[model samples]
Target: MGVLSGVKIIEMVGLGPGPFCGMLLADLGADVIAVERPAADAGNPRPWELCSRGKRSMVLDVKKPGAVETFLELIDGADALIEGMRPGVMERLGLGPEVCLARRPSLVYGRMTGWGQYGPLSQVAGHDANYVAVSGALWLATQSGQQPDAPPGLLGDVAGGALYLAIGLLAGILRARQDGQGQVVDAAMVDGSAHLLNFAISFLPDHYGGSFEKARPAALGMHWDRPYLCADGEWIVIQAVEPKFYAELIRRLGLDQDERFVNEQRNPAAWATLGDELSVLFKTKSRAEWTRLLEGTDTCFAPVLAPEEAAAHPHNIARDIYKTIDGVLQTAPAPRFSVTPSAELVSVPPRGAHTKDVLAELQINSKRTGDRGQATAVGSPG
Candidate 1:
């Protein structure tokens, strides 16, 4: 059991962020019912849909008769409901916040989207990159002369979208329990991405002419706060942002005596010159050599390890941060608790695998469902 042991949630499984939010809630021991499209791929569930882990899935085609009513039955008994359809889809399907809240006065309705409900772009379609790009969040990843790019889904989907919705739902549920009222939470990747940039914004006035549109920020321009390539072609990073840590970095590297490293740490004038020098210097040593000399020190150093390498890393192994489940490698649920730990990992299930059971539990009957309910699905995920 986990901290959210008794929480009840109904999730309308959609793309990326919505399923991820559901997975996170389930990981914390919420009793989650994932209402998926009837056409989802049950015969071939993808590994990344690890988002299905610990969730009980029900397949219901809202287009079919009695489907919306079935969902309402779930909503009536749930503490919260999450959905990621385009702004009006739920309304069109007759499962909007107003209707659900009427059914359950204290139900938390969480919506995840790229733009947000009522925004100019809310009804439009978008993916993770477009959301961050429009929010000015992608500029943080831009380096000199490089196009803005990042690992897909991390910034906008997982962080800005999924995580924000998860927390928003939890907060709403808490308030609902106390106040006996509920409201909808509009969690947009655009809004959350902009909020996530607040910390980097603090250093903006001294960076790139004080605007993200101009160029990279100050930290990227720092001599000691950059990635270096080793002779063996592996990459290593050091982000000694503080002065004392900067001193530790150069001293450990025996560059304290170097004239270029002697200047004030924020001196942008010295960055390019020192970067050129350090680039050549770092290439002289393999990553292993630098790991021995500087790793586990105050230099804020880390070697860039790919997923498999990260799983094999000593620190990661010691902390039990990564594990293989059903032959797919993924990180463990984060934000460790000293008291109630995260629930055990559960294997992914076929889509709509529990449709009959769920329908039976709710004693629901629709034209599309029978005593045994829908069969295993073979279509792709939504």
Candidate 2:
């Protein structure tokens, strides 16, 4: 059993962050019931969809008769309902928070969206980049001010949207447990992405060397905190922020002979020159050579590894951070506990994979268009 073993969630199937939030809850052992559309790929569902991992699936096409009531029946037993629909889509379908909260007084209604429930742009369509751009987080992508770029959806979708929504649902659950009244949690990606800039915003004055114009380069270099290309074209990064760590870095690189670096480590004026010097110096050795020299020391150093490389790294292997299950390479469930630990790798259920079992467990008779008459599971529970 996990820490959240008794918690139950109704996950309305949608794109991106909604399913991700469900996966996180499921990883912590929530009894997540995914309400999906009719299985178009009923016979050939992908079992490796990581975002839907560790969840039971039940098909609920609301256009069909009595489906909405069936959905409400699931909500009655659930502690939370998470959906990544637009602002008013749930209400249009007659399954809004107001309706759900009436049926289940303590149900946490989590609404995930890029622009949130209100404001002018709430109804407007947007993806990760747009939300990050509007939220000022895209500016932090200052790779020396060369057009900010990041891995797609990592910032806005997963980090900002899904993560914040998960926290909001958890908080709302606690609140409902205290007072039998639930509320809507509007987790906006734009708001959460802006909140993510707190570290940069709070430290801007102390870090930018008293010059706002220097912030870009400061972000790029950040007191010797940057990636360097090695002789073999692979990369290694370092962030020796403190003077003593800087001492250790250069000492390892045999650059202790230089007074310009030794005496003037913290001066903002010297960073540009130091970065340039290191750029030249790092190219002289292979990334493997540098990793051997700097892997375990306190220089805050690491190689720029790809996902496959990261999964195989010694440290990651030692911690069991990544696992390959059913030919799928994915990270293990995280934030482990000493008392009630999270589960290991959880399998992704096929669409409507648990329909019969879940309905039987809830004691709700379900109807559908299928020849099976009763709500037979669409496919094997792969």
Candidate 3:
């Protein structure tokens, strides 16, 4: 049992953010029914594709006659509906917000997209990198003279798209429960990515002591705010931005007595020189040696561990941050609750694995139905 134990969500299975949003809701104990397309190939499904955990899968071909009616019947009893199609795709399929909300007035309709439903580029095809590039987040991630290297799908797709859609759906569900009315949550990746960059955009102008032209370098490329290489070719990140932390870092490196560094700690013109000097010094020790010296100190230091290393780290092990399911290692459900904890992981379902079971549960008899002779239930229950 979880906090959202009784909540029901109908998920229109698509790619990327939509599935992720459904995964999050299912993780929190929502009874999510994923409506997968009939005859669509999913290739070889992997257990480590942890997004599909804790959900039931059903096959429904919306293009088939009466299939939309069957889908709408599921929507009629749902608290929310999640979809990630292009602007008018759902409308064309007869499962748009207007149709679903008319059937179930309190349904939280969540629409996830790169450019939203009504933007100038709403129907344009794009992925995570394109969305982040347009959002100015990718630009902000670049160093002084380096090309902007946005992370692969984490920033824009998962963070901006899936997380924001989940939040919007939750908020809409709350509002609907109170007012008996629901509205569409148009979660645009471009909009959410821009929103995520708010802190950096607001912080740079007023707080950074350098020209706007050199802002990226001054802020991120500073000696005390970046990663350095170790003798073993591993990396460690140091972010001693505050005076006390910086002083501690200098002391640990035995550079506190250097007159040039002591005098130029606050000077923007000296950052590159200081960074070069620090780089040379950092390369003298292996990552483990530095970790032994400064891992738990206030120098604001952390080793840049790879994914495998992170899973085995002591802190992660203590917190149980990762779980191995069926020999597949993956992260645990996050933001735990004290009262109603998230349910344990279940096996990811094969396509249409629960079709007969779900239809039976929904009380729709497929024996005497429409064109395809499959289950079809139309309209809201009286």
lDDT of 2 by residue, 1-382 (tens): 6789999999887767888899999999898998775545333353326888888887766655676777788888789998877878888788888899888999999988999889999888888999999997777755555878868998999899899999999999998999988999999999999998776666667877554445553453544777899999999988788888988998888889999888887776787888898999999999999999999997779999999999999999999999988888988887888999887775677777887887777676654434221231221110
Off by over 4 Å in 3: 39-48, 209-220, 368-382
Candidate 2 segments exceeding 4 Å error: 41-48, 209-213, 217-223, 368-382
**Candidate that scores best on lDDT:** 1
- What 10-residue stretch in candidate 3 is worst by lDDT? 373-382
Clashing pairs in 3: none
What's the TM-score of each model vs. the native?
Answer: 0.91, 0.93, 0.91
What C-alpha root-mean-square deviation, in Å, does candidate 1 show against the real structure? 2.9
lDDT of 1 by residue, 1-382 (tens): 7888899999987777988999998888898998875454432444347888889987776655556677898887799998888888788778889899999999999998989987677777789999999987887766757777878899999989999999999999999999989999999999999898887777668755687654464344666878899999999998898888998999998988876696657777778888888899999999999999999999999999999999999999999989899898988887788898988786787777888788877876544443234432122211
Q: Write the per-residue lDDT of candidate 3 for residues 188-211, one digit (tens) a residue.
A: 999999998777766766666434
In candidate 1, what residue range of length 10 has the lowest lDDT sum? 373-382
Between candidates 1 and 2, which one is better according to lDDT? 1
